[model samples]
Target: MTDPNKSLWTATARPAESDETSHETLHGTHRTDVVIIGAGFTGLTAALKLAEGGAKAIVLDSVEPGFGASGRNGGQVIPGLKYDPDQVDQMFGEASTDFIGRAADTVFELIDKYRIDCSPVRQGWIQPTIKQAHLPTLKRRLLQWQNRGCNAEWLDADRMQKLTGSPCFVGGWIDYRAGSLHPLNFVQGLARAATDAGVTISSQSEATSLQRNGDNWIVKTAAGAEIIASQAVIATNGYSGSLLPKLRATIVPANSFQIASEPLSESQLNEILPTRAVVSDTRRLANYFRISPDNRLMLGGRGTFSEPASLKDYGKMMADRRMLFPQFPDLKVDYAWSGRIAMNREHLPHIHQPMPGLTMALGFNGRGVAMGCSIGGAIGEHLLDSRVRLPLPFSEMKPLPLHAWHPFYATLAIWYYRLRDQLEN
Candidate 1:
């Protein structure tokens, strides 16, 4: 049985040699130019940008930095949204495509500019077609990105086998612009950068209530501390709570579980993903995997709609992993953990200002690692200068109808998808 408390990333990630930021707790009343709630990638990235631009930003989180999805994701720096390029163009129109395209590239630029030591590999990411039926969709996705001037390449079975060192994939496409990294370390690097730039990060400071006071917004913490700011950002993506009841109702938080095996032998590594690129299969309930810098095989997939009580409950995932890579059928999983993913009905991120002085960016679906980081900068720019245009259109918060029944709906959807995936296979 895997340990549910410890994730493979947390267990194996290199500790920061030196942390320049002070782990101060929030106390008393404080005032800042901008107050960001949540210390994940989005909040930290926004705080870093705002601080760099000479804004006094204060970031508050209920737990330590990178304690959420920011640190607990697959770490695939995949460029683009959950939607295909053509779908985005069709949904939001052609005029929005350029901004969306540029937004995807900003994630890599941020990592480079900050010199984040997250074991990032720019080898690229592969979305392989697991079945012949998936080939058309893969081709359409490739053409959509190519139409948007993206440097993507289609890979035949031979090329896929050469790169992945596996014959499971029939065909695939490689996005050179996409890559992978140690997600936790990357978020920690962002925290360091944000603090170095003079952004105040208060850990263990949960914002309980938000109220408007004249021209300013007052955020009250559970410990009775308060932050009064001219502008505020609700950057809490999946773990968003009742702090903003309306905002919480706008999206559903689905759980994604991941498992990692003990370090593989050099020979074992050579026979699987020798090029060390991130690979994800084309399935409704897809599976993604890559080799860690230390040679551990990290695998992730959509788990139960509800959170599991223990890592031992993920037998299905373990079986799935073994089936996918029969070459390592005896792989023993050392760590298992799960995190919530904020999903919207549209499967795209939602950027909105539900009220004056309050801006929110959430519902990245499962693409929050790159999209969250990029959108953070956009949030910083937007907060700094309202006139600045955003990559995603700002729309009013549209609460999902019958939001209370989301859990029921989520369970039904998961079952439907799982059944469909089985039927297709």
Candidate 2:
């Protein structure tokens, strides 16, 4: 059954929601220097950067820019991968070490220079230790980041509880460079800015197929709209679809849900997250949250059994939120939505040169906001100068071995975690 809520994109034509209803061209053929697929961050970033470099990039989105996860995420601007800095360095050879290290810092720098006003707040990030044994891993990661010139400081258990106003965490670490944003607004701003920078963007233009012609590639839409270009960058990531099969195997699209509560009183806000810091417990299956601008707690989690029915059902998400903050156990949730994230089994981002004249940037594993922004620029520069180095040591690898296992594994995993969360934590 087709999802009716999925068509909501057709109406939301804002920069935040993939609005470009004004430029929806039907039954037309166009040509450009480069054609990009998927208007989420990757596609938008590629378009913006390529256009600024004097390349005519025709950005085609099946829906609209920020229509997908790019617009509906937790708005976190986290610095690095889900791995320790040293472990990340060892994944790729020594030659890519410095590049990966620099990338951890550059993601935030891109967000700053763009002046993206998605309610960005530099309140820092806290990775609260989920188990007592996890404290060693946290300490090891901190030292690793410090060795790589990252400004990370380990917080004791007392300090962690005091800062968070919750006794759920054993210890944590603070990366001062990390922050958060209003996701939809941020994506909208990026699309608008890139369009203003000379990138021709088209919404409602779903890419149906891609084929290489002599020296260029042709991007065709279901409506028969065509764009021919010398180069193509598939930034579809989690939504790569048939445009690339390898992406489907290597990047699995997983969903996470978020619920935002009605604003709290001044006293209530201070008692909840006084410092305004974004927090996430250190778990393979994790819960992430932060205080919204209006003082509502925006909480995100992974184990959603069903698509919530209404706003009232969204409020029930607070029951899960209370697992961390007992203070706001009965918080009134105002809005709720879910977004899909692309996770590489390896948990590292990839830059793929799948075929000649094609490059793919994908797999942020829920950290796509900052990762996508920086990768867009990195890919644009590389397209401009082939010798340009990226922060990640990436290569094109075959897609997942058994694709059908994803949905089943996803369901079973969620069920297992719910049981574990009930019994253990």
Candidate 3:
């Protein structure tokens, strides 16, 4: 099977010494103040924060850094959750709204602080209106962020065309705080930063079992390695598995697919996203697109329930690209890949400490780049000092009802959403 993890980011990202240093199979016994499983953005961020706070942290991952969605995502650092500010306030009180409003800042701040050379671009993010009826919702969303002192702006059809070079979009809004970067490089940078800060990271060391041992938690890895720590964190997001059956069942792993065009000429790039702002449409199954640092046009959206074996499976998404940008009807596809995103029933990130000294955070619902980092930092702070409050409230581990049949349910939901999106078009 073709490895879908080899996305555009991996193909183009510069090699990092940290990745080389951290890529090793775990063996023998190890000890730390905190042990973290899954070295994606959340785990690495938490590890870096913990190490900076003078705590010993050991990070273990089934694969190398950015091997999962953290490296394979759309790279759009979108702020906030799927819900609007008011909806968030209603659901989780006023503090969460404030926290979410500044989520994307975490990404940029980390990039700046660590000097991670990930092709950071902070122009902004555009949420283009796919249907006329979505305009009101877009306007309301813009106003809510504006009221919260966000750098939000309303874009009429003319202005939208000027910014995005796509005439199909009627209107939209741009959040200046949101941005894009080389996601894989960013995650690798995080790994390097963590390692530099005295954290130990091991790759290809899948935690098989976790147990309470005396005053510490013992984590057994696939390679027969053991790690004993005062605290443990399960940072596996969409790639979560049977290490904790209930935790894995709490989310539906939805595959997201993407394709990148060959690097465009200056003229071609000018006719597309000239300002370099990343864009995602206001559709049920939203489509995200951006111009990469190399000037390749990239577009991504929901993929099939089953894993794709080859590039031919991306036919529909390629068609979507042509439909949205008919001017580039003959654009050559240079790269294609897919990765899973954890979708929660509530569409909000869940923080659970099912037991003392163990923390589990997952289900970013396609906003892992920004929100994941925010949540990870918060968890790190909480671990350092128990009185620290998390952005999201800790909830009981409630597995979705009929979780085993999620594939069947997800297929139906995708079909319904596709039909509705077509109707809207």
Which candidate achieves the best TM-score against the true structure?
A: 3
What's model 2's TM-score? 0.89
Cα distance off (Å), candidate 2, residue 229: 0.6
The predicted structure with the larger lDDT, 1 or 2, is 1
List, in order, the clash count of every candidate structure.
0, 5, 0
Q: What is candidate 1's CA lDDT for residue 157?
A: 95
lDDT digits (tens) for residues 1-425 of candidate 3: 23444678878888655445746787999989999999999999999999999999999998788888999998999999889999999998889998888888999999999999999999999999869989999899999999988998999999998898787899999999999999999999999999889999998888999999888999999988999999999999999998999999999999999999889998989889999999999899988999999999999999998887787888878988988888878888888899999999899899999889999999999999999999998899999999999998899999998999999999999999989988974
Clashing pairs in 2: 13-19, 15-188, 16-188, 62-206, 249-400
Global lDDT scores for all candidate models = 0.85, 0.74, 0.91
Better of 1 and 2 by TM-score: 1
Pick by lDDT: which candidate is best?
3
Which residue segments of model 3 deviate by more than 4 Å? Answer: 1-5, 17-20
lDDT at position 223, candidate 1? 75
lDDT of 3 at 76: 95
Error of 1 at 253 (Å): 0.7
Better of 2 and 3 by lDDT: 3
